[model samples]
Target chain A: MTDPQRIWTAAAVIIGDEILSGRTHDKNIAQIATWLQVQGIRLTEVRVIADDMDAIAEAVNTLRAKHDYLFTTGGIGPTHDDITVDAVAAALGIEVIIHPEARAMLEDYYETRGGLNEGRLRMARVPAGSDLIPNRYTGAPGIRLGNLFLMAGVPHITAGMLDGLTGELEGGAPLLSEVIGSWVPESEVAILLRDVEQAHEGCQIGSYPFFREGRSGANFVIRSTDPDVLQSCVDTLCEGLGELGWDFTPGGI
Target chain B: MTDPQRIWTAAAVIIGDEILSGRTHDKNIAQIATWLQVQGIRLTEVRVIADDMDAIAEAVNTLRAKHDYLFTTGGIGPTHDDITVDAVAAALGIEVIIHPEARAMLEDYYETRGGLNEGRLRMARVPAGSDLIPNRYTGAPGIRLGNLFLMAGVPHITAGMLDGLTGELEGGAPLLSEVIGSWVPESEVAILLRDVEQAHEGCQIGSYPFFREGRSGANFVIRSTDPDVLQSCVDTLCEGLGELGWDFTPGGI
Candidate 1:
């Protein structure tokens, strides 16, 4: 997301059978990836694994060691199907313990609603030396075990955890981007896109095509850690598009 | 997605900068996963990586060797940024060659639209010793090199390729499922879900909670490779729900 020497990378482990079964469409991957960019960390890789404990441990252990940070979602709800905490603990070679603060928080939150029971208490289990990532909307706080952050599977609940983590992690310069949308089919200007991308060192361009308004269109997204370089790439692309006689929108359509 | 003893698993490599940058929400993972399930292959792992060559190769090589099958989506378009073919070729220690049939397909398809150009020809390239997966909608065919399937990032085009692939690969019995939606908080019925899942050796029930129509509700999805086990699990869950004095919708809300 920043200088080559200082780029911060993160990997996400999405733990759920529902996702792998295609019963639930994933929303956390995009949300977390977007949020990590604001924190100046590049979301380098993501793994969507099932609810299996061995799979969970294997993924978490592999990713947590390779990247600067690893974030996991799902398998931490009230039901028996929710076994993320146990799996992660097994992976880390640590004992699962009831997090006192989290237990207290849940106790207080559920006090006004239904009293906290054994099923709800499942939310309090975490690795022996883990900390809590605050959750504003729900009783269960996200788990932070060293470099690994265990979050909720629900999109909105994961948003609450991310909101609590804004500007918290150490990261490098933020990645900046500029998008140019045009009606011209990307194939028409493929050479031009290639030349522009090659001309910039710190920048990379992505072409996303869409069919809208009964015609083909594309959004050319230029990304770079350096704002000046990004702008220059955008300018050069715009000039090339102009020379090609393609009407373009500065942002996206 | 099938019998536990004969379970077949797959991993997907989503090659793109757009996905990691959060510019595009990926639809391919769910589509492929659902398709894989119907074929009795479990979608075990998914990796969303950048457009970098090394990253792509590392992911492809690692996943292709580990799983029974590996799929890749994105970076197969007609632009320079579309380098999935080259990257995958490098991964398998093979050279990138233009398949003559794919080249001819493009020539015929583009004859009525625009003449085939150098940019358009890029789609014809594939790893050495690869076969074609038919594309009924687009000119460029999907690539199949042994267990690795190189597919389009676009949803509908990938659908066409998948359609061509139906009943082609050997698979076990398909996983069956039944869903029961109830207007009860998940915490209230966690024990019931646990008991039902335990009673059925081969079945698993996942609780997906949602808030709708001024009430909290959950969908208990019971899944198993055996249809009878799945149905029994669903029936047991329904009986439990009835015993708990909770009304449930048979399918889902």
Candidate 2:
């Protein structure tokens, strides 16, 4: 495999009070991370902050500046508290404007319902000169401004928007992983795993241990952008475990 | 209640490659956030970073300086990949050493299973001058260094550590919440929620919309530090919803 200087990376800012308050459990971090991975873009960092405009703006500025791409979820609905667009716009030193296409879409969607009211019109607002990401689940569209995409807080709605955005991103090679699980305590085989990972040119190993079924066990996940390298790292680790007389499962327990 | 300039806040740095790679869904953020709320310490920010030493150390330094307390979960296990101890020690410019109590606990816990070997001895290591947070689920005790805590990546083990450290930290008044759920779409009642919240000082309302029972619904959570004020806010919100001809459920949907 050829050497690469850096991997394409994305950072997510989860904007909401519910998540931080623990009233609502956050699923967006995992979702966005998974989606970015499939696109060959690694999600490197995630910050869950409150709905405060200043906090949102500061986080947006910091993350967008640092990563190749940035995403924000929450505070995009048709409510007074939904302030992501305004916050993001302020951060970028731009104005918040109602996107005509978004307004038209909402108008059409609400035609049979109650029609677009002043509150419903809030969903049409976006950072100046931004486009829209289609939302098949709900009428309000996800906003996209350059490399920063603002999505929904709702898990299923976020999934829909992500689906609409699949393959729309430019990314590098996708990372491949192979998992090996064993009842052996991770401490017993830490060195073996590390040595195997070090021996492999482009692979890294992650150990996740758990106490389950009345026994201590761990799953070793070997990751590499190259599928062949990932496979070889897994094989080497498996061979070492076999030599140690430790029983392991190939696909994880 | 008097308006406070800043709430006692804490930030969490989840250090692991599994979470970033989406191979593992993070539960520590919610667990820690919930635990902090009960202790009157608001979990203001959470940054999930990679297993890289530089990233973990930088995040720990940045957040520890910003908040009253900072927590890190994951990479505290008995594996080579578990470098949280080494990374945090580097960040604090401290040395790493084996804590005698932790070593003794491991020795006792593993006496019948397997004696403390080199691999298991990894669990005994801690940053210089640190104390141990007891773990009932496992032998590896959580590390406590000043206002920073290093905890296990596993949910149950982390829970055990949290249980052991409950009420140990100093904090302010706990934030209280009241939930009012309705079948009405949030946009239809956005203005009402805003008006009620505006009229109620020291209170903020968050709207969470969901789809259930083949219809769209929303839950408005009113939060405040004062119980009387929280109750008043909930009462006002309920009155507003009733006036709008919407049937609502108390305590959320």
Candidate 3:
């Protein structure tokens, strides 16, 4: 029989030379991931590529086809390297066009700032048959083509764009998670974690070990779509840790 | 004509669940990218995937075949969730074996602490015909099979592994970059930046716009393999910015 619960997955292509060059730390991956989680979509994979058109197009095409939704950030500005629109259009095998609403927004925003120039006008370009994702912070609206979303590279601007798209997409049940932290080495409790996870049908446990303040510790994150399964798994894990003489914090360390 | 300079490229596959869940912010991508730059290798692409065997193996196979070198971080711990070795072995179509050296190191490390158990012993497992990358911080050495390097998920442990591999790989000329920051909107100077970049044969400019302290500004990073070309490009850009009556910081603001 087919699965009762539909799993919605998404992928993000972070297009920027600055990030690949290590000149800029990317904040969009986590930002978008968190946003997608809230939207009941799981972010399955993320690829960070350069500003090159071929690379951008290849990543966009490949990821957009594989996942339920694809999000791209960066290369949507007015600079020469801002070739996301062209690359995405090429990826979709379509022409790039200026959205009337986007152009009007740019014109209105830039009217008192400096008026639209060739560079500013470039912000209006998008893939053919696309809608606009509003950018409350910037004049340039984000482009949305089918299941593809092109957002700003700037973290706060991307945040604004994500805010605009919230509740607009259809997704499955949101994955729920719980964390338990303890001052114990993960190796000591590996078997217990494995056993507990296997015993719970839908729950998966992730162990994150850390060495802090001259001591070893770990935080166990348990995830499941079902709340009942999630709670039972957490209880079993806590019981197992207690049996092993380890103290664990429910909310993590 | 064959180019004398060989451009070395690398791709990274970050295997983890915490990162995908947005429960943990990834620090390895930037850290690895910066380290690769110092080794004169360009990190062309990076994929962050969940800790699933199929996902890990697929990403490994695809990226390792495409780039000069491939690096994977995460999923190398002692827990059941640490499946990087198995995934990588499957990807390479090799059998997993316990490296004697790694096993001995783990035994020695755990002698006073707790003695090697099944979980701790799991750290010694590696793909066949593999060499070890020294991990000074922990007993578990990173596994190196051919051009693939599997490192720890922890940032500090990964840093130690990267240190052990520095200057060991063959590479081309290191890319050099200079940044110029100005209190000007990028769109206002987009044409000048484009023209200046086009005039320079080998240099590529990346514009990063920012709105800070109630002012709009941008930092233009100019990169080139040749130091002479890089300096010339920077001089030309500074001159162009000056000609436009805008003052720019040489070392960036």
Report the Cα interface RMSD of each model, rounded to 1 decimal.
1.3, 1.1, 0.6
lDDT of 2 by residue, A123-147 (tens): 9999899999999987899999999
DockQ per model, Cα:
0.72, 0.79, 0.85
Clashing residue pairs for model 3: none
- Candidate topping lDDT: 3
lDDT of 3 at B243: 93
Best by DockQ: 3
- For B1-253, candidate 1 gives per-residue lDDT tens digits of 4455697888999888888878788888899989998998888889899888999999998898889999999888899899899998887888999899999999998898677988889989999899999988768889999988999888898888888888888777778888899999899889999988999998989899987787789998888988888888888889889998999999987
| Superposition error at A53 for model 1 (Å) | 0.8
Model 3, stretches more than 4 Å misplaced?
Answer: A1-4, B1-4
lDDT of 1 by residue, A1-253 (tens): 4455598989999888888888889999899999999999999989898889898988888888889999999988899989999998898789999999999999998898788988999999999999999988778899997788999999999999999989889898889999899998888899999999999998888898887788888999999989899999999999999998999999987
| Candidate 2 clashes between residue pairs 3 or more apart in a chain or in different chains | none
Which whole-number lDDT from 0 to 100 does residue B171 have in model 1? Answer: 73
- What tens digits encode model 2's per-residue C-alpha lDDT throughout B68-104? 9998998888777888999999999999999999999
lDDT of 3 by residue, A1-253 (tens): 4254999999999999899988899899999999999999999999999988899989988888899999999999999999999988987889998899999999999999989999999999998899999999989999998899999999999999999999999888999999999999999999999999999998999999999999999999999999999999999999999999999999899
Q: Of the pair 1 and 2, which is ahead by TM-score?
A: 2
For candidate 1, the docking band is: medium
What's the ranking of the predictions by lDDT, best on top?
A: 3, 2, 1
iRMSD of prediction 3: 0.6
